[model samples]
Target: MPFVICLLFSWFLLPIDSAPAVASDPLLICWNNQVKPLQNRFVQLSYQEQRNELEHSAEPWQQTPYQASGTIWVNATNFRQIDTLRNTTRNRTSFTKTQADTQTLLVKHGDDKLTSVSRAMLDEHPLTAARYSPIRLIEYAYQHHLRPDSASSTNQATCYRTTINQTVISLFIRRADGLLDRATLLAPDDMLGDVLTTLTYQDYAAVGPSQQPTRVIVDKVNGKVRDQVRLTQSIVTDQAPTLLDTPADYRLDMTPTPVATARSEKYSDHVYFVTLPHTDDRVMLVEFTDFVLVAEAPLNSENGELIIQQAHQLIPDKPIRYFVFGHHHPHYLGGVRPFVHKGATILCSPGNDDYVTYLVQAPHRLKPDSLAMAPKPLKLEAVGARKTITDGQFSMDIYHIGSQSAHTSDYLIYYFPSEQLLFQDDLVWIPKTGKPTRISTRQTGLYRAIQQLGIPVRTVIQSWPVADMGVKTEIPFAELAASVDSK
Candidate 1:
């Protein structure tokens, strides 16, 4: 009776082992390939990636990838790569080099310190996961359950779902050949929830004693795809790759610090101009009877905040009533978010509603911007031909250029008829040195638009200044016209 009671007590006190056991054999079986099994071996893969033009703003674009080709040297847990990408819009090209050096999956981009691969890249690529190693997956399964994926129902493929580091990954294996067919990973990001990334392995060919996927497709964020492998050169050498090594001449360019001085220059008695350093983008402040109006909230949120802070310090009495946008390019429009958070009304051009809507809707939880922390209802007013705001003493006219450039489609120019001051963006890039001014096709169009508007202007306030060194404030209208008329 004593022995029976003790056995029952022990049984009640011990933890229940009710969870089903996951077999490592099945996972290893699924990870194998006949041509080339991906394991603890080093691989050098050269692939080409072509980008799709999709404007998603929450994720900042580092490099414009019209077309790029790079060679990757990777082992089980580490890799070094160099990607040469081209910016088709700017007609310029640049190179970005990255490498993983440590055991904790820390990667370094150029001269920067090592950062975790997961934190550095938006997409958790399969190549970075060591696809051939089932040991990691087995260990993960011990902590989390690995079960059959019911959604995958192909005649030749069997799918299994498992969670690794909070990311849900589904692996599809070919039943006949036991090769990795596809792996779909759903990673929940703070900014974008449940971001889907897929890797498809196809066209298996024998490289050495093992088989390798000659063609692989990596489906990235926002429907962008990196597919096709044209080059099939592989070597199983024991020598370390020099391409993986960081060059001695590599240097990271530091960004210019934004000066927080509330210094304001008088464009006129009622109008003030404040130029933010680094980019030399200026914000115009129009003082009215009841409230103040601001023009062109450009660059980023920090820039917008600095401008608004300066505006508040300068005026201190009137509330900022309207925030006007000059053009709808991502470069100039980033500052709109901060103004929106401040309860200012946004006045933009037609077709700009969609872009603004996207701006407010997209999640910024990754970094948690100023606007994201202090949320506000987005107030936007779309104008077509003209929109005017006045308090009898002072008035401002916003005019749509009705001209499209390779830069932007719908551009708006702000005009102060009373001051005879025309404020425009990217129409004419003023030469830093006043040596000789030659007008391009863009400048000619801008001059014609000003003529058509019948607005007499004495001075032109180009959004971008002349130079960082010797910055020129307002340009004489004659100098701008002479450049075109003289030619």
Candidate 2:
């Protein structure tokens, strides 16, 4: 009688195809079933790829997208063996690996021996090689707080959703098949409200008792496909992988260092030019009767604070009332928040008000900044075609260099009519001593704008200067035109 009862109980407990699904922790289910099974296989993969060329400016005139072919080798325990990519354009090649038995990241270019990242900085920095690994991907998801938002079953697959807050990462996993289908990362930016990066994994193939995606697509938030990788071959090897070893001659420095001081000079009675060392980027400060006006908040908060500190020392009684952004580029706009924290009104091109507003108000809890701590409402002003500011004795003009310019559509350049001085941003990047290697279309446009405006320009102060170039402090307009003509 006991044996009969035991058999009947076991029969009822066995899972059925049509039965209601038992609740399962998605991350754990994927890790245990999918990632663990691939732990001991040594894998090799080759793929072709195309990616957008990374640029510093908001918009670049002639930058082109690039395509490449690469190979990746990995050990099953989430260790990168080797990854090499060869660009088709110039036949340039680069590869990355990690030290054996160490978490240190290493990289090498064509004909160059492997150079490892500083071990001191290794722990704090995230390794790119590990992020996409089958095991590491699961580990990363587990480390973050994961909530099972939903699950659904269809076509021999079951997908589960999970999210990470800071970068707004959304993960979709097919738990039944033990595969990650897609991940979306949304990063709020100063120019774009939300920049999306989407990764899709498809065409799964079996290799040595493990399944791996044979093709992956990466897309930008702008609906442009940024990169694609398609697998050519996969191999499971038995011998110990040798790709992680590095040559002794290669070197890498990982120590974080202090930023250098900016060089400052008084261009006019109240107009000052400050050029940051190493970066060769300039910030212009104008002392009005009651307050100060800063042009071009380039780089980050550290750079912004340095500029502000100098402004305070020079004009102790006044606050920075306005911070005029040169354009909408991320590199130049990073310092706007620091000025906002100091109760300054952010001034930018007319259309950029919404983005700047969103920027100042975005939550920064994870990495709280000065703006986040103070929590003040942001003040903003917009500049149209031409705006002028005067304080009885001194007057300044801000002109909108229309979209016809090469670098950006909505750009602003500062002109000090009294001083006959002009502050130019991306339009006129000059070296310290010599002419530019080539005169860009933007530079020519700037010269035309000056002529069209009929403003007397004695000297042009460029925001970006090449470091170590032996040149004068300012470029004379006549000499600039001559150089362009020669080019």
Candidate 3:
């Protein structure tokens, strides 16, 4: 049946139709007949011509005659991991980059004496490999997209593709010129949690005859920053080996220290808070049950990994029984891979589970350490307006956030019956002493939800904490909202 339809559609397209000739400068015409064949997909011809023209240009790829390698070192200042509850300052650290076998090997040493996260990740999880150079994005965009019409649906397209280590990658190009725009890497849930890594192009010049961003900044979209180095320049050369021939050992180094202790804040005997470290330069903690019911997966995979560990430790005597995906974002839910690996039932909102399956779960991306981690089919239970999880005496009511923010869809907030603690990410922020610059309507809606839901929130645990717990009483949700409206 499918083949017959395609044959008919092709037959309908092969014959040309008569039409009046039209002409203009940009020369865009009805070409309705010429273009109708493309209505099923997006087509931009001039783009292909431009690209083919560039691929044939003379560009430098690599510098040969690999010389005896020497190392250049630098001491990083003001470096330490931020804690959800506090900041950790360790000894001074130093980093060096050395060329070996035509590749760069980075060595990090410091007085604070912390293990390098990049080194640890590579060593522990051998499966997840460092992603390819951002340059491939241009090539990927050209090959992967069939046409603009096909790319038009907001939710219809699979956002990315998978790598050898089971990582899903989204490669993008400019909408108009079709120039390589950016490349994004999402970690598999097994290691970190689905988290986004964005590499933006910058500082373009003709590398040979093609334009490319020499200084690229790869970081999380929300400023969960990673590195900021001038790309310096790109060398395109015929000497450049076929991408398949490129050595597999080259790696991108991460500056974060290896996280050693991920502890849960025991709120009540029944409730606990697990802090997740993120590159976004913010602190978020996941709240989960003892036997693994519900996950507070808030941010990216870094946060996702911590929540997974919390679930495991919360009740080491038992495995995680249930996984609660707190919100939906291409970055946030990608980390659920770990829960899928743990074989736990997942609790999520209506559209959320489908989003997870299509965007994150279907990808099953892994990191450097675990090559075998794959996406596991989950037993999903949907939550409507409210859902409750408790142990006879103690309970938490998880409510869907009612706000006009696309920041988090399928967003949920949890309230503790005895602790008077309420959680709603981005709903409100506690202002630190000096008058804050302003607030937002999302913050205002949080205030409305608090009153409307009648949640006796003594402590507001926002996705991004407004103030440290010690100074939380000074939080002004209403003032923050008014500030936004006033602006």
Candidate 4:
């Protein structure tokens, strides 16, 4: 889970007291003063919001700015939110909807398919919860008990601090009107180090019986603007009986099918391909005389644990000694922490030691995983232009797909000369139906690298997108060469 989502769920577990022990507590007094006016202002509040955000993607340092527009409907008991994001660069438009009550939460993504999970699930997986909105935050605090720990006065605002499950949440109220001016959360992030997220509310406008902020600016402690939201419209109306209920026509599933088992296919006596259930991600296992080497840890720690179990089942007794990273992307490296916990050496392309170290060492205290419970020092090794690992009986060579490629600079591929096989990630995508209509620069890069290195690669295996070209994981090298030569 992302740190922000985990932090939000941690807030749900806080013990809510009806009132402060001491009525004279200044922080409590301020909190009450701020929340009292909006207690019973409206039965149903709805608003259309436009969001501009700098979202973090595969590369933590490279933030992508996107624009999304959505509408939110909230009542005393239930709330619904819908957001549509149109990515011009990718020529794709995605839609997401989240509706929740005390009992259940229903989420719809892109299509009519809806997933319904119990509200309790949010405690562990908060990504299913509604997106962060100032209105939603105010509604939650007003309905539930917010215990303020301390209060400090700034020149322009009074800040009240609340600590829940070791996560610090501070609200800054304007001294003049007692309206909320800003909110800040201090938490630990695996990629950004310690993150201090601040949301500043501005341009208040009257809505029914209360005032709503027309503009909200989200910023990080690093002075980067993360998101800006504008309230395009707002209205209050009488509550309807089933406004937030799941639609009858929508197909709903109770819970996500658990990926408890992995499917493995043996390519050779010493080599196997393993794939997790319900995902297109895969990993390769190479067995040696004493130990095993696993390539690519996809998804999260749970998947990583499954990979470890599958390896033990396939090649029993020998411990997994080395784990090779396909790239620095989150989907590829998200499971690397589990390998560290298992005492395996992490092999990655050059210039990723600090990143791999951060993944293993960052604080997972909010929701402790295996590494957090039993900490381990990162055993990291960098693969330069080319590095080989062998035990005489079995050998695997790691090669860097040079920076000149259109893809990432740190991308690495594995090869076995004896078997004439090559393994890579994100370099080739064989369409389910087309025959080399056009070739991408990424494929050209891989072809050039193979030609320059003079390795005889008869077959290529991909570690991602599990199903393509008739459910087979291997693609002939001639097919790729033909595609690169076409057009």
Best by lDDT: 4
Per-residue lDDT tens digits for candidate 1, residues 1-487, read 0012223223233333324434443444543433124355556667665653434221233224476677766543456567776667667776766665433233444566544344333234333433322223333433344555444536777666654444556667677776667766655343332345666777776654455566666665533434333435654443346544444644333344456443578767788888765656777899988788888766567677888898888888788888887776544676777788888898878877876776665555323557778789999998788988889878888898755322445678888888788887667755657744445676778888888888999988777653553534467888778877877
Worst 10 residues of 1 by lDDT: 1-10
Residue-level lDDT for 190 in candidate 3: 38
lDDT of 4 at 237: 54
lDDT of 3 by residue, 143-168 (tens): 33322222212232222232323333
Per-candidate alpha-carbon RMSD to the true structure: 10.4, 10.2, 18.1, 5.4
Rank the candidate models, highest lDDT first.
Answer: 4, 2, 1, 3
* Worst-scoring 10-residue span by lDDT in model 3: 45-54
Q: 303 in model 2: Cα distance from truth in Å?
A: 2.4
lDDT of 2 by residue, 392-446 (tens): 8889999988664577867888898887888877666455655578777877888
Candidate 3 regions off by >4 Å?
1-261, 278-290, 298-305, 365-375, 404-407, 465-487
Taken over the whole model, the C-alpha lDDT of each candidate is 0.61, 0.64, 0.41, 0.67
The reply for model 4, stretches above 4 Å from the true place, is: 1-16, 20-60, 69-133, 150-177, 181-198, 202-209, 219-225, 232-246, 249-252, 316-319, 402-405, 431-441, 468-471
Cα shift from native, residue 267, model 2 (Å): 2.9
Q: What TM-score, computed on C-alpha atoms, does each candidate reach?
A: 0.67, 0.74, 0.46, 0.75
Q: Give the Å shift of residue 319 in candidate 1.
A: 2.5
Candidate 4 residue-wise lDDT at 130: 21
Clash pairs, model 4 backbone: none
